[model samples]
Target: MGLVDTLTKSARRSSTTSSEGATMAAGYSAERAPDGNPDDTEVLDKEEGNLVMALISQLRIGMDLTKITLPTFVLEPRSMLERITDFTAHPELIFGAGKIEDPKQRFLHVTSLILAGWHIKPKGVKKPYNPVLGEFFRCTYHYEDGSEGYYVAEQVSHHPPISAFFYVSPRNRVIITGELKPKSKFLGNSVATILEGEDRVRLLDRPEDGEYTITMPNMFARGILFGKMLLELGDFSSVRCPSTNYSCDIEFKTKGWISGGYNAVSGTVKGPGGTAGEIAGHWDQSMEYKDKGGRKQVLFDAATTKVVQKLCLPEAQQEPNESRRLWAGVTRAIKAADMEAATAEKSKIEEAQREKTRAREASGQRHQLRFFEPVGEKYMPNIGVDRQVSGAPLAKQSPDEMARTVKEWLFGEVSTSPSQSVASGTQATPLPPSASVSHFGSETATMASTASMQSLNSVAAVPVHVTAPGPPVDGPKLSIPPPHAH
Candidate 1:
């Protein structure tokens, strides 16, 4: 949405039903606006703009650093449905009024919930709020440099987050479009914090020099998954990843630990799978293994043993001192997770492609995979109609009733105004023209913010550098401008 919808003081605040009540729908009202600067009014070069334009100009190519970074578990949307089925799974996280009554709906937890800004919610509650009917969250871009500008979302939908924050790039379907660069360093009420060095956060960091040496005291220290039974042992470390999802020649290294528990680490991670000296933290640490080409692998158990010794240092030195030797362990499960996620995403794309092919075959036309569709004067959904209405997608009760939820959620019926040129009887809209799609104007501003944030909290330099390519302005830089004083 534009400034009037997402950021305007007058915009209405809405909420989807809390699992607290059964059959309860969303309640909405105008919300109290936060006292902050407005969207862009002046021309901001990269440094001052908080608008999406400032973060990225164009989508980068190749495997995204984010796609392969951290554990593969971080890639796909979380399974919210499983929790809905078992309220006890995450008792404190439930809040929907509908969930409380229909035990079924509450049990049907989904990954995608509507992003509602209007609902009046109690502070510190984990259940994410959804927006109300007819009320759109307007966004106004205000550069910290005091510049002013405005842009609107393509259209409003149930998947507010997916629509407003991440659209598929018109130039590249694989590229996640739009910018989510928060105007401020952090969102005041975000339930999860990924700051480096903060024990409260799952992951935290502190930057040193040319590199950012990140240390996750115990990554996933207290995480809960389906199979993990009581206090189980897991790997932990930090990642200096590019904000965007694209692949490129990047560098990274981690040095944390492996306590005397069930196989500490087991995996291998190499940049783009094409870089040199590709090192991976593993559990097997096999002394020898043959490759497809029939050559024995180099740097096996011997190298890993040295890393294990380094990790054995006093907790203080292992986590705090870079001089203690920098060698982070990768795990096989972690590597499998990466492979599984990639396969899943690829499968999703391929299945989608096959369906399109069948549809075209039925119509006597060959399927043409066009990644980019011009949004000139019109906005279309990033995924396009090819995927919509395909299969028996839940056209049934609202999203709250679905078996699987997604990151995107909306609480009302969808209706776009001024639409024409019907496709499948319903006029197809372009993504940019809708008040929900076109926020990511550039990626540099996004990375610049990441770099600046790391600079402020880092204690050691991370030799491993990960950055998703941006609109080719001037490449990487030393520093981002200081926050503008109001």
Candidate 2:
């Protein structure tokens, strides 16, 4: 029998009621008495058993979950596109690049900023939706300095999923381009996801060409077999600036077999002439920096920093393909604790996508990526030039290699000006000033330079200024496109 059929039979054998099979199929919550509390110990135990059976069935289907259809209850109410915004939580670190001339200092600041951007959800185990091919999400950030920054992310590939993102700040004259290709493996009790791409940050106005290349650490979903589930970032990652000869190696420490540490990161920043700065801290909390002078200072404190809020048009005004707009029904259902409704809505979208894929295959057509194109082995903007820089490559090595590297840098002698190597196997060129201005998303080609969102029905209302200024206000009004003709 099929896995679903076996699971259904198992559910039926658990209880006398016919509703038990239906409940298991729908991932129903434990029944409650009129008082709104759980019904009884027997009912609770049976419900828990059903869930365990379902989880077992899911694992039996596949060890690699990349292509599997996960239940709606396990999904977080957001898309991967929305999750990428965590990088811009602190606008100062990005926009402040223009003020810092020293490459070493700038590299240090950028590394600290990148480490600070990892935000954990309230429920640590919930997963974000796997974006559909050609799906796009866009939003803008209004900084306290009255300057605006825009971000765009697209799911540029499907077979081996890849997310391409670009964030441009005209006022700061900085651009961030990245491709995310995660390779995940499910261990018997835990899952490991390795980041298989590099991200580049370039300052457009800098006279000397330089770019910061960053690689993220691997992630782990632990405690799956028993106990409370937890998400932990493991292994190590680094940030390097090739032109400046300054580099930071960040080691994310995972807990050991017996006991060691969790969320702990320690690294050394090597600059020109053997000068080094020490960085050590917990990623979700705060980090400390000891400069070449050996004076220690708090680099970033997530607990105290006022994270900038991201702004996106309301769902009603968002394009059909925007993350919020596409997942509105599923999000509503999840929020209301209606798992059945959430599953149904999510299935509808997935089924539509599958049908489209079948049609494309039959017609010998392909789903064209709207916002990004494949660059080398990853997806990046087809437009724009690059600014070349030198830096040591962020190599993927075993834990022992990383430990030895860190130990040599810390206890043993090492070169201050390490020879630079390309992380993406190519040099990044900076975009020309004219090319800096671009649109927000694929559906709504609204000018990115415009502060106010374009409205189709009437003249856009004057935005009320708050603690921070909003987007620029001088462009033709635009509105969300009507739903795509499916």
Clashes of each: 115, 15
lDDT of 1 at 80: 16
Model 2 ranges off by over 4 Å: 1-49, 58-62, 382-459, 462-486
Candidate 1 segments exceeding 4 Å error: 1-125, 144-155, 159-162, 166-273, 276-486
Using lDDT as the measure, the top candidate is 2
Which lDDT tens digits does candidate 2 get at residues 1-486?
A: 764455445444544344334334334222111111111001323454355446645664226668767667667788877777777666555444544555665676578667867643434456687888778876655443334556778888777888899776655566788988887775533567778787888766553647788999998765333323567788878888888888877999877654565678899888877658788888877787776676776656666655555555456655677778898899899989887899899998888778888999999998887666676775655433342112221122222232223223321222211111112443322211221222111222112332221111022222211111111222111111111111
What TM-score, over all chains together, does every model reach? Answer: 0.18, 0.70
* Candidate 1 structure quality by residue, lDDT tens digits, 1-486: 332223211111111112221112111112211111122011112222122222212212221222211222332221111111111111111112121232111211111011000111111112211211111221111112211111122212222211122211111111112211111111111112221220000000111111112222121111111111111113343322222111111112222233222222322222233321222323222222222344433222312211100001221322211111111111122335454554354354335545755786699974221122225422233333234442333323222222111112211111111111222533232221211111111211221112222221122221222111111122111112111111
**After aligning candidate 1 to the native by TM-score, how far in Å is the CA of 340 from where it should be?**
45
